[model samples]
Structure formats: C-alpha cells, structure tokens
Target: MAGYKFFMFDPDNGFETYKTAEEAKAAADEAIDYYRGDAGDGWPDEVAQVCWGEIKQETQQVGLRPRDEEDKSSCEMICDYQLTDI
Candidate 1:
C-alpha cells in the first residue's frame, strides 16, 4: 500500500504526526482514553470532532456557540492530518 501520514490533535498535548494511519489512530484513541480518565464529559465531543471531520449544529442556536464550535472542525479526522510532498 501507498504510504500515508497520520495526525492527531490534543488540547493539552497539542498535535502529533505519525508515519502511518494506524499509528495515528492509535495515538488519537490513546489520547481520548487519557482525557476521558481526566476530563470527563468535556473530552469526547472535542475528540470525536477531531476524529470525525463533520460537526452538527441546529439553526436555532445563536452567535458564539455555533461559531466557536465551527472553529474546531477538522477535515483530516480519519485521514492524513497534514500533507508533505517530500
């Protein structure tokens, strides 16, 4: 198979890049497990958002909540976190 890079995001841990998708997923899963042990409910929504690119919002919510949540959206959830041509 073709080579690919994996990226993971953590609030306290920042971001990490790995040589393959499996490595990246493992890192992310580990991060979630760590955070879940420490942060409780606040962790998953953020981690899930990172692991999954899409975010859902209702039309009725106003202003900052929607916008703030939008800012955290990531398109690279299940794929390469960053691309380096070299």
Candidate 2:
C-alpha cells in the first residue's frame, strides 16, 4: 500500500486525480461538507451529515465513483493510472 495509488476527485474535470491518499482524503472531507449542506465554510446540517453517514457505509475510498459505476473501463482507468505511476 505504500506504493503510489491513483484516485479521481472533482474540483476540476479531466485531470482530477491524486497521487496520495491524504490528497484524496481532503477531497472526501470537502465532499462530506458539501453534502452536509454546509456553505463548505460553515457547520454541517443534519440532513447533510446523514448523507455523509450513508455514503460512509457504502465505501471508505475517498475519490472513487459510486458503487453502481462498475463499468470495466472505469476499473481499467484506475488500474491504468496505477500503472502509469506519474
């Protein structure tokens, strides 16, 4: 697990990838805040927190797509990035 891994997150499109888990994690925290209906600079609301809770039950991987996106290309892309090791 110490070797580099690839992750995709959005604040931008196209090249939205992370080289480290910590980077992906920051994006996940931001996503939780966004879902929590925070101004993203303010406290989280109950509904948003509940949304976070639900997604948490789904997966711990920060920048991964939803569980339903099981396309082979998506899996390939993650692997492709890992292989590239940029």
Candidate 3:
C-alpha cells in the first residue's frame, strides 16, 4: 500500500507518515491550525500561507517526492514541506 507524509520541521520530525490520505490531511490541518493559532504570532503570515499551499498542492495532486528531491528547509520563515512516500 502507498503511504502519505505530512511535512513538518526537519532534522528531527521531518514529516509524519499516514496509512491514508485522510489521515495525512488531518495531520496537515492540525499543523496548520497550530500555525494559525496564537502560537503562530511569533511567525510571519507567510509561514501559514506556505503551509496551506503545501496542503493544497498535495490535495490537488497527491504523490510522494523522490528522496533526492526532498527539501529539508527549517520551515520557520517559509513553507518548504514536501509530501513524500513513507
């Protein structure tokens, strides 16, 4: 079976794998909600926007990225999360 990954901070919890797309989407929504909540005040609006874009892109065309194409950005200042296979 294929797996879905919800992007997160790298070097530690880079991303989370889900057995289904719905699960992955829920994870993505939870992350986005956190970023859009009070805790997000420390971050720029772009961060949330970037995260939303990542989720949107994944929903539009679900797929995993090649390991070589993975972007390991800190995802602090910008959205650099990439959905990948588990």
**Each prediction's RMSD to truth:** 15.4, 13.0, 13.2
* Ordering by lDDT: 1, 3, 2
Q: Which tens-of-lDDT digit does each residue in 1-86 have in candidate 2?
A: 22335443434222234556576666566665555565566654432322111111111333444334555464433421122222
Over all chains combined, what TM-score does candidate 1 have?
Answer: 0.44
Cα-based lDDT at residue 15, candidate 2: 23
User: Model 3's lDDT to the true fold?
Assistant: 0.45
Candidate with the greatest TM-score versus the true structure: 1
TM-score of each: 0.44, 0.31, 0.36
Which candidate leads in lDDT? 1
Which sections of candidate 3 miss by over 4 Å? 1-13, 39-86
Model 2 regions lying over 4 Å from their true place:
1-4, 9-15, 38-86
Whichever of 1 and 3 has more lDDT, that candidate is 1
Q: What Cα-based lDDT does every candidate model obtain?
A: 0.53, 0.41, 0.45
Candidate 2: TM-score? 0.31
- Sort by TM-score, best first: 1, 3, 2
Worst 10 residues of 3 by lDDT: 50-59
